[model samples]
Target: MTTRPGRGRPKASDGADRRTALVDAARRLFAERGFAATSVRAVAREAGVDAALVSHYFGDKQGLLVATMALPVDPAARIREVLDGGRDGLGERLVRTFTETWDPHEDVIAALLRTAMTGDPEQAPALQLARAVLVVGVREQLQGPDADGRAALVAAQVVGLAVTRYVARLPHVRDLTPGDLARVYGPAVQALVDGN
Candidate 1:
């Protein structure tokens, strides 16, 4: 016969709206607390849902971090597309996509990047997580003994440009259009991608 319920976890209210809420909550917490300091349970609590739902929806904290990242497109996929068209203008493609995608969203990207790269003792963990999430794919695509080094070199070019243009707002770089920036910055990135 039917018996009354004892202590059990509540049914997860899973759906698009719930996922969006969790993402929104996660974005806030991640930005406010930094990725290393934020937890899955904290995101669930912020979203007003059971902790299990965070795992159910996002797999884990890293998964949640992926979902909440500010980049509007997959940087890896964009790189793949640039690679697909061959190496002739590869640098331009890479730089163009980066400039176009990151220009309008510079403020948000700048804050996240600044926090991660500040070199403050308190910011080290965030730096590690940022390095993992942001450019791991570039490492894989390089696909060689020194893939990580190559990818890191590529990242340095892009991140340096982003910081000088967007965060620091330097005179010449800030004055340059995306096309102009791509023309200037693309070849260096291509060199790294080519292992040159």
Candidate 2:
């Protein structure tokens, strides 16, 4: 009686699928319970995997949260698109860029922000991931004789806009039409990038 190579455990072919399942489960649970309340063991249970598997795959709860919150869109590609035009037009470009990219239905960027405020260890990983990915990207474009200060300024403004528009849902702020946003807020963003 010949048997397949694998014995007790399922084949590694399913590992990728299982990891994906784990991340999905973790995202749902994290959103429902908040990062502090969710446990790795619970995530594993939800994913129908061994608890150790969760650790093995994600390292810890924080790792799992970061993995779970990853954006489907490629951030580098998005950043490149936003920064493509004349550097002087960067503020308008950034506002338009985020308005287009941060579709509530397309990616859970806002949801991640909501959880990030909790300051939980689990949440920290994801927050750090976002800060590193976003700040560094902006910093990269800004790091130069003329752009260094502008980049930092622009990054701060972008963060503030995201908080006001999405996380806080400030009605007046959020209600601004894209065109109006460009007209009103564009200067602020430009100031950030322009070192004004």
Candidate 3:
């Protein structure tokens, strides 16, 4: 007699599918139940995988939350890349980065932005993920007494750009090319970074 498929921990070839299942489950539950209310065990059950896989794949619930964002590139790593380019044209770089990262994944990122806009950051996983991914990521990479303030300001700019351009799909902002938007918005972000 032969056993059925997908009844246990997936084989190496199935790893990607297993991971996708967990992310899909987490995304659905996070939307329906809210992030804080969802549990790793519930996600595992929803995905039809062992609870240990969540820990193995994501390190924790917070990591799973970040994974749900599902951008093609890693946000923190990309943030570091821009930060490495230094303060010169940093604002343009930031605008370019934000647009490039979210443009292809507007539906996913827009949902995250709405969660942030409507939910309390303290209780919302999506907002916490935003702070941890963008705000804290930026803050940790900079120096000086104003680093925290600068990071928060930059985060605000990035968030506004996301809401207006992606979520709201504003005609003027959404119609511009990434390069064009960077040129228009970068100076303001750069000003914040330069503490002007």
Candidate 4:
């Protein structure tokens, strides 16, 4: 016997609808409570969907953040790309990759940096996320007793460069082309990486 379709809910549309709802809820929560404060359960509750769906859709909170922020580049992937080859010129590669990734998205990067630096309770999570990306990426490539300190130094250098060049629009830093910046800044970052 053939079964007829019943008009109750559309099965095919449920996935798309739920995905949309999840993204919308995540966007709202991330903006309101910041990345670290907004939990998967909270986003799910706001979307009226199961918390598991958030994982299914975004893999994790970081993934959700990338989506919510509409970031032009994926930090983890870019970090891996920069660190892919041997550790010979990691600093240069990292600096070059960072500038290339952020150049086109200066406005977005500026907004994120502002939010992270504001010291607002709601925005603290944003700062943490930034720290995690930079520190963790550098730490993974380093080997020694002072890995953490070195990682922090690397993070500072990168963040300082971003703030001065992109956000603050410093005359000298702002004027350098990507290659010039990489050539000038790469050794500084390399020193940090080498813990020298």
Weakest lDDT window of 10 consecutive positions for candidate 3: 1-10
**lDDT, candidate 4, 1-196, per-residue tens:** 2222444555654444877777778767665555667799999888776788778888987677666656657766787777777567888888888888889877556657755664454544645765777788778889877998998888889888999977788999988878888899999989878878
Q: By lDDT, highest first, what's the ranking?
A: 3, 4, 2, 1
lDDT of the structure predicted as candidate 3: 0.77
lDDT of 3 by residue, 97-196 (tens): 8788778776677657765665566534545655677776667666777988998989989888888887788988888888888999989998887777
lDDT of each: 0.69, 0.70, 0.77, 0.75
In candidate 4, position 17 carries an lDDT of 81
Reference-based TM-score of each model = 0.52, 0.60, 0.59, 0.61
lDDT of 1: 0.69
Q: Which candidate leads in TM-score? A: 4
Off by over 4 Å in 3: 1-69, 119-127, 140-147
User: How does candidate 1 fare on TM-score?
Assistant: 0.52
Greater-lDDT candidate between 2 and 3: 3
Give the per-residue lDDT of model 2 (tens digit) for 4-113.
23436666654447788788888777766777788888888887777787888888877787787787766556677776675677778778777767754322566576
Off by more than 4 A, model 4: 1-68, 119-127
Question: Residue 114 of model 4: what lDDT?
Answer: 57
TM-score of 3: 0.59
Q: Which ten residues in a row have the lowest lDDT in candidate 1?
A: 1-10
